[model samples]
Target: MTKPNLLPRSSDMASETSAEFSWPPLESNPEVFTEYLYQLGLPSDWFVGEVFGLDDDSLGFVPRPAVAVIVTFESLKKETDAVAAAKVDFFMKQSPKLDYACGVIACIHSVLNSLDSITLVENSILEKYYRATKTQSPADRATTLENMTEFQEVHTSYASLGQSSVPTAEDDVKHHFVTFVQNALGQLIELDGLKKGPVVVNAASSDILKDTAAVIQARIEAGVYSDSLAVLTLAKVADDIDAAVQALIDSSNGVLEVTSVENKDGAKVSRIKCTATGHEMPPRADIVTAHVNSKRFKKATEWYSYDFAQFEPYIVSHRRKPKCLFCNVTGIVLNKIPSEVEKHMQGRKFVRMKEHVKFFDEAEIDKDD
Candidate 1:
């Protein structure tokens, strides 16, 4: 079957007049923005997560210690004063060619500045932009960004909202997207595309997420969104959760290297050693158990009810030869029915296979859906 387009589609905002065109408005979704970042060559370790509502409690949904928060808020007359009164570190103003795309770029710029782990590839478009504008004035930096064709292309492509073709101009909308971040000194900064400089929210704390939310909340209460708070959407740029989990699994691979130290009377003396540190490494069995208990593992087995209906024919055709669902190698026999399969399931090989299957299944499900 031809799978449906799993990509996000933009709302009907085609231009009424043919003379002018604007970039399509992007969805304020973490997954959509995250995938776009990946398309821009961001490493898998980083992603964007959306905060559903502007409520203080809603901040808990996003990963903590987020590199930056992308906030979509209604533009108001007092916005300039509100941001100025707060602690502000404004960046360059948005270029005319990249009007709507700047907020997304500013969010990414915050991540690049705050998070050391979210590094760009060597000689990357982002790297070049960073280096070129690192010492330039905000105006110069903005000019430098406007000329970066590759970066603009990727941003525009994602901004297309999965349309096979898009209009030159989008319906003129009033809402604006801005980025909130706590700099290295622990001061909240707002980066808006429309603004000439970053707005500093006069709040400083180690927990930037909550503090930034409070700032946005304050703005909402005083600005146009005060009446309708749902207009505010937040996305956190942070390290990927799955990648962090996988790193734990990888760290468990501290080799127990054996080396012969000396020979005594033609007998060799050896010792086994592990050189890895930073955290107490779990045993292989514990790692396997963790994998089995993961959500990915549970979801992959949805198609497998263990009624043996799907496997009975395959099992019989192979003459009782049972292959591990995880390992894919067949050595265990299906001679004894469910008991044999159940017994095989406890083995490490099956556990390893389950881990692999879970990863594959999750990827397939994500891609298909």
Candidate 2:
């Protein structure tokens, strides 16, 4: 959806900029959107996986039983007209209650409302929000969502992360996020919070993945998205895979055979083989702890810790191209080995960064450097 029209005139810009209620613009990254779901009490494994393409092969990247797909694209003129034409009566009739962040929230609600098979933990924000508004119209639900302080707080928190070190006054009015999911009726529906209501795309299908893929592919070919640039992704609202694996180990009544599997990197990882279900999985942290505590597995190697005495204040980088957080510069190789870390620590650039971190601290260094 578009940014809220809080500052329509130049005179109002000053007041709107100072206003606390103005929705901070968020990044279009799936990670940010996924974190918003986590803040709403979803598990860590219920993640947003980005789809690189709209073809059938692209579906492989997405985890199965995907509750929703959020696609962000540069809206084309004809595509915009198509969306306006296909607007449902329910949402079209009502005025837009939800403000700028409606697209993200709408996708969240659409997934929770439609996917009953996916279990949301009891008393979760997703569960509670769904139950409280299950009977209301989509428009009414949007109205309720617009006023929720908790959601606004969570949305604002992530949006702040998208803010750059250099604040800009110009607003980019190109990218928009829209969600796609199979509604309770088994029809693939497009839920754009900016739109009046859910837009019906197709009827019930055995494979919603292929159905959704086809729809997305058509849009890409129709010039709605410049190939590969169109952001298409599937965010599954499901249980944590790690948590599920743990549950299996806890409940297994079969012979628990513990073995050390040699990983590709020559590391000996603990493997738990359960005879009951013939399932084999890597041991969870707690399971490994139990084994170590009970002396089932004894440590042979000496415990060594990296001491970055000369390193700067860098937490860690998650981006594709990692950088030195202390230096505020990119291209620093992410060498996890202690020796490599120590070597990087002794570098002149890092030493200079250490001085800056000591003087200004991490936040100020990020801002001022």
Candidate 3:
């Protein structure tokens, strides 16, 4: 039998007219916005995180090489700010029909403007939406976004996860969001869908984030956003994730490396050579039973979990013993030694098991839900 179709059908969604096209306000929290970008084609490598404050100590917490910043404020005025827009770098107006959409609109601006550093997922919802609106006039682009059904579905799903009580479409909201992006010309500009065009914040912005903080701080001092003000930044999770993982393995104090691994019956012992020193550190049976326990190990399994942290989601090591949750649940003989780990990790069945583990792993994490 054919698998049931997983995607939401347009008919399954709440339809809207210009007068009734209101979405519940999205939360400005990091996890919510990070998932927003991921669903809209932002890769797992980049994530949205909160920028705690404008002070040097607080700004120091910001992840380095951040691409875009989105700040939220409660506007006391009923209308958009009366600032004159100029030199449109990248600006798409939010259709008047798309109410309570400023948060999502600001995120779109963040990703589109960061395309220089982003390689979007193939034909992801945001990728297609970008191609469709790239050449359109600002008004037409807004109309296209207003009619996009997939986006509407994704928005509604995540919006419900907000910690605060959900508001109805007709609820009046004064909170608004805007993004700060660096244009191709190296100028830091603000993209607010409510504005006529890009607002130039800094012409020669040596650092867009610090400059954005300055702008946001000024607004705060002037009584904008008052209690509801917040800042969220879309930043590269790490400059080199793989290399970072490698460094962790390398700095294991010479515990990970082995000149040779020999299996003695059911147990495998390695002649661990300290790379830092030219001497060997034997895998001794001190007093400890095992570095990990079945309960300490998540209820999952993997072939290469012994390799390094990058493969952690797949497998994990307790002492030198590589444990797999697959074995635990299935009552199969766990790989008892280091030497046995290599062949299993390299096996086609184990390699193909990544997605299976991923699905199972996500289920485990969201079990609380």
Candidate 4:
């Protein structure tokens, strides 16, 4: 969608400025478009314009060249009243063409018409009375009697009563108000002759489409309509449903695939996969040991192997050579216990073995003789 170009034009001497301006991006969906129009404060008429010659000194100033269109029933008798006649007045003072004005009016009319249909479905009786009041000319008691009878007939039916169970008095009142607005808008569209053009309704507010989808699904289930249309509509709803499902997923930090197991010994175990590390393990235990001595030895060996495997990547990737700590010697065995090992690590003194060596030599010579 093209954004409104209401920003001031630069006056740099080195640059050239164009006179033509671009239109703002139109809302494609009818439902969203209608809501946007209503949000703009319901203009009696619509207008667009182009502005020029804005400067830094006039910061915060509303330029006269800015487009200002008004859609109002009131005559432009006074300057102030004319400016305030419609809720919408684009910043530029330049007048839009008649065709542009008509197009905007038609778009607004279509949305109002759709809203009217929804209102009728919500409240039939009140909507009928509202339409009569707006469309029919003022009449005597006799003329009103016919309208009164028709209104009663339309409202008093069992179907209408069933549809009118609106939960609360406030809901009924709101429905009546919307119905009245819808009736008024219908008259306006007829008066403006805006019924022929393409009427786009915002898909977001398309309750009719939702209703249609439900009906299609029901018919398909009953073997009436073909599966194709029903499937397509369902697919659309599925997209929306998936979005809702995804919201729940997002709120809870994604879905978890869990596994439960029970051993023959009646022990229960649960496992979960970590998303970050892609590793699966028992939920409660980082390490487990069995009571059997043989099993204990096997478990210890497995634990050592696992530990070594975990460190292998780091060991292989390291750039520097490993050295012994006790004697500051390279290519020596690395061990946790000094008494069970022969080689000492670098950075410490080696044990004195001269006395042991002399005793061992004397014992060997005596044995040989």
Q: How does model 1 score by TM-score?
A: 0.53
Could you estimate the TM-score for every candidate?
A: 0.53, 0.53, 0.59, 0.17
Q: What overall lDDT, based on C-alpha atoms, would model 3 receive against the true structure?
A: 0.65
Give one digit per residue, the lDDT tens place, for model 4 in 1-369. 999643221221112211221112121222233223323322312112111112233211211211111122211121111111111111111123111222233332333334322233223332333333333332221133222433223222311222324232222121000000112212211113212212212222223323323433454566644432201100000111223223332442332223555533355545443332233333211111111123533443333333332222212222242221222223234432333223331233323432232223577889999
Backbone clashes for every candidate come to 13, 1, 5, 25
lDDT of 3 by residue, 201-302 (tens): 788788877899888777666665465688888887543323333443365543345455443223344444433223343332110011111232212222
Per-residue C-alpha lDDT of model 1 across residues 1-369, encoded as one tens digit per residue:
999743221111122331133345565655567667666556544556555555565554445546677766565655444445333333666667557655555555555555454666556656556656666776766665555556556666777664445434465645567777766567777776566566667456666677766776776667645433222222332222244434444553532223343322254443333332111211222223334455644443332324555444223334333323322433344432455665666767766655544224577889998
Q: In candidate 3, what residue range of length 10 has the lowest lDDT sum?
A: 284-293
Candidate 3 at 230: error in angstroms?
1.0
Error of 2 at 327 (Å): 18
What are the root-mean-square deviations of the candidates from the true structure over C-alphas? 17.2, 16.0, 17.5, 29.3
Question: Candidate 2: how large is its RMSD?
Answer: 16.0
Name the best candidate (by TM-score): 3
The C-alpha lDDT values of all candidates are 0.51, 0.52, 0.65, 0.26
- Candidate 4 stretches greater than 4 Å from native: 1-35, 40-98, 115-369
Q: Return the top candidate by lDDT.
A: 3
In candidate 3, residue 94 scores what lDDT?
A: 76
lDDT of 1 at 110: 59
